[model samples]
Target: MDWVVKFARSSIGAKAVVALTGAGLVGFVVAHLLGNLQLFAGPEQFNNYAHGLKSLGPLLWAARLGLLGMFVLHIGMAIRLQSMNKAARPVSYQSKKAQASTLASRSMLLGGVTLLLFVLFHLAHYTLGVVDPQFLEYKTAEGWHDAYKMTVIGFQSAPVAGLYIAAMAGLAMHLGHGVSSMFQTLGLNHPRYRPLIRGIGPALAALIFLGFVSIPIAVQLGIISLQGGA
Candidate 1:
């Protein structure tokens, strides 16, 4: 019991938890992107995909709950670690210089907080449809929820699209730092593969940012439209 408590209270333990949870979130991001990419195909395809996810029923709720748990753990530990770091170094350096830290690394706290807010906004905008009445109470001809229409309508406005793009920029920066740190936290960083591992973070972040922002940009540019069954 003492060991358990000690481990739970330790910084290393917190870092490990963050790494593991971050890995789960990265997987979710990729999977979510793939699912949404169905939009480019057509409404039938996208709506059907949505229906399939809804058809999961209990499994869907399970996944959502699991993801929620991961978010709570990741954020909680991250804040704790940050506070510990600050408390450990209460005095500011007279001549401070960051040799290894990048801008993304330094802004992790800001980016993480920004991303948390963005996620809540995103869920409200699309998941709960609380932000826009247009996203709410919409059904397709086949009696399914018209996700394609809702998505297009939500992103059609220049303001909404701009916010999404800005949020994505923060997400990309946060992800770039978080992903690379995971390997170091997990003891997977190797000298032989350090270059590759370091590059993977920003590259993956860029990929996700591009994938997600493209939909809104496409909708704004008229490449995707409700009339065209997007």
Candidate 2:
């Protein structure tokens, strides 16, 4: 137990923890995107999917709790590592160079913070329905939560759609650097596979970004909407 605590406090261990937790988060993101993509299948299919998850009862809550734990650990470790790095270099550099760093890597902290804010807002808007309580009251013919209608109506607002698009862009930027960094920290970025590993991050990020943003964009363009308005 003592050794566990000490290792967790160590830099190498911290990075490993971040990498592991980040992988978990990435899995959740991809899974979530896939489920959300069912929206294109129409209301019946989408509502059934949402209801099926909710029908899990305790299992669903347990999964949510596990995800929350991962989020807390990942954010806490990142902040600790940042503090450690700053403490090690107390003096500002006379001049800084980013010749080898990509913009995604350079802005990781900012992008992460942006995504955090967006996540909170997203939960409030959709998960809790606080942002639009009326949407939660929507029910399908089968009495299941009308998530499809809620989503379409919610994204109909220009402000909501714009915010969603911007947040997804930030998410893409964060994932772009975080994925490759995770691979490196996990000792999977061998020279032979470095290019492929590095490319995976950006490619996955771009796909996720497009997938998520397409929903709101489609709604805004009237491509995805209620049969004849909410």
Candidate 3:
């Protein structure tokens, strides 16, 4: 167990864990964005999509729990690494220049923590019954929450939609740094394709952010309504 902890704390090993987890999360975001995209198709389509997920019953919950666990572990490691880095900054270096890290990279750790806070609020508003819920009783035939209707209701609020946009913005900031770093951590930073890594990372992050944020923006713009449509 001691050696396990030590290995996890090592720079290379820590980066390996971060890279693997970050890559997995990118895949998840893609799927989620695709699913959410149905809102543009209309309510019936979006509802049907949500309903389909609920139909999976225990299987859906199991998948959610597994993903939640992985998310927690990934976040914990990130927080740990960030803390270590902050602590290592010399105390007596009073005249130190403050321009070492690019703003995006320097603040990703902070944005991640803020994003975590947003997630909790989001789950409560849209999923859990803890907060002012979007749909009180979207119960499925198998007693699962009617996730489709709930999603529609939650995004109906102009304010909520705006906040979601902000949260996705934060997600983009984190991913902008994360994607390229992940490839580097995984030893994929070949000199021949370094440009590819740099270019693709921001592009992918932009797509993910834009896809997720668009639904809310469209709703707020009145270009679409979530009420009776998907």
Candidate 4:
């Protein structure tokens, strides 16, 4: 029990937890983006995809609960570690140099908070259907959830689309720093391949941000629609 308490309070253990959870989250983000890309395939295709997930019943709920737990763990540890870091510092350096650290790294807390807000709004808009009443009753001809039409209707609002795009930028910033930092935390830092490892984060962030923002942008631009032939 003492050892467990010590480890939980230690910086190293915090970093390890962050690293593992961050890696898992990155995988989830990739999968989620891929699944959402079904919007481009049109209504029936997208609705069928949504139906398939719903058909999973308990398995889908289990996955959702597991993902929720992971998010809670990751967010809790991040705030805890940040507080620890600040407490240890207590005072700012009179002359902080911006030598090796990037802007994304420096703004991790901001990015994380922004992403958290976005996630809440997103879940409300899509999962809970509490954000937009109009999209709540959408259904396909076959009685499946009309996820495609809902997406189209939701993103049709310029403000909604703009907010989504902005949130994705925050997500990109978070991931840009998080991916490389996780590798370093896990001690994958080899001098020879440090640059390559660091580059992976930004690359992945860009890809994900592009993929996510593309959806809202496409919907707003009328390049994708509920029916076939956008």
Candidate 5:
């Protein structure tokens, strides 16, 4: 419809779309972290969890596709909104001061780009079996994919683990600002609750960062390994 197209082209609508898609992505991130935490349960439990998800077959692919769509829309709208903002102010300011902007907010674009590259590398390393094909060949006694073994062995490389840690830190910074911005865009930032709402973003970002990076850190510390210690 014309109205739909017009709304989508408007800055407000673009922001709304970004906010909603970002919320969806955040939900996925939390769910993914929870699933990843199964590694602490040892090989059998982690393998079973991976197998269960793979057993979904078509459903799994559908979920992936849905997530991919949301990711694309979120990034696309964000870039478009940035362009619109720049176009509205073609002339550069004589001097700029970040009185109200935080470092995370100022570096959102760079952080987004970094995260995008990390996501692609992650997919190649774990999902596609491109980084290390031998990992995919690993199988448990039950014949299920040895995801636990793969994970432990994959992070054995200090470089790989360091990259993951750094990426997670970047993710935390992005989410710290992005989450609060999403709430404000959605009009949930009431004066009475603004402080609490703003705090939620950084708190959640820290939790997610810890949750994700814990896997690699535990691997490096030998707390989680193929030796059945974890």
Candidate 6:
């Protein structure tokens, strides 16, 4: 297991985790966005999807546990790598040439930590079903469960809106730096296609930020209302 541990601690391994997690999240975003479009369709469509997810029984829990494990591994590798890099750079360099690029351009470690906090807050707000209990009070026709209500009410608070939006911005910054960097680490970097990959990375990140932020905006704007007052 010595070689396995060595590989797990390597830079390429850490990046491979990021790439895989980010790619997995891409699918998550698609499903979430599609379900959210039910906002236009009315509550039945959206709430039913929410109930269905809960009803997935052991399989749903399995998926959550699996994702959590990947998330933990990703964070652990990141911390280890950052510590190793800092050890390598104990002395400060005094020139622009000493550093390869802009702080934002070269600071994925910092960005990753910021993104980590954002993810916890996100799970608290949306996934844990506990961030805003008042929001969860909304119900569906099945009387099975009504999750969309909680969302509407939760973002009605200005503090929640501000916090959620700030998290999304952090996520955008993190993704902008992470995407192509992961590609390069995996040996997929090519002189010819580098520019294209780099260009598209930010666009994908922007879409993620905007899509997530849109729900809160809609609620704050009164475009979507909770089913009833608590």
Best of the two (1, 2) by TM-score: 2
Q: How close is candidate 3 to the true structure, as a TM-score?
A: 0.84
Q: Using lDDT as the measure, which candidate wins? A: 5
1-230 in candidate 6: lDDT tens per residue?
A: 99877776776666676677666655565577767767644566667777888899999999888777767776676666667667888897677866754365456666667777877777777767667664455556667666666677678888988887887787778778777666676677789998987876688789888888887787888877765321
Per-residue CA lDDT of model 1 for 1-230, tens digit only, reads: 89866876789988998999999999998999999888888888899999999999999999999999999999998888878777887775444344245344568888888999999999999999889876768899988889988998888889999999999999998999889889889998989989998999999999999999988888888888886644
Task: List where candidate 4 sits over 4 angstroms from the true fold.
Answer: 1-5, 98-106
lDDT of 1 at 116: 95
Of models 3 and 6, which has the larger lDDT?
Answer: 3
Residues 1-230 of candidate 3 have per-residue lDDT tens digits of: 99888889876666677778888888888998899888777756776787788789899999888788778878877767767666787553444364435355567877687688898988788767676643767765556555655666667787888888888888888888889878888889999999999888789889988888888777666656635443
> Which is the better candidate, 1 or 4, if ranked by lDDT?
1
Candidate closest to the true structure, highest TM-score: 5
Give per-residue CA lDDT, model 4, range 1-230, as digits (tens): 89877886798888787888888888889988998898888887778888999999999999989888888878888878878877887676454463244344459889999999999999899888998776768878887778888888899889999999999999999999899889999899999989999998999999999999999999878889655524
Which rank order by lDDT, best down to worst?
5, 2, 1, 4, 3, 6
Instruction: Name every residue pair that clashes in candidate 5.
Output: none
- Candidate 3, residue 67: how far the Cα is off, in Å: 1.3
lDDT of each: 0.88, 0.90, 0.76, 0.85, 0.91, 0.71
158 in model 3: Cα distance from truth in Å? 1.7
lDDT by residue (1-230, candidate 2, tens digit) is 99999999999889999999999999999999999888887888889999999999999999999999999999999989878876887776453453345344458888889989999999999999999899889999999899999999999999999999999999999999899999999999789999999999899999999999988988898877787321
Please provide TM-scores, in order, for all candidate models, with all chains considered together: 0.93, 0.94, 0.84, 0.92, 0.95, 0.84
Worst 10 residues of 1 by lDDT: 95-104
Clashes of 2: 0
- RMSD to the hidden true structure, all candidates: 1.8, 2.3, 3.2, 2.0, 1.6, 3.3
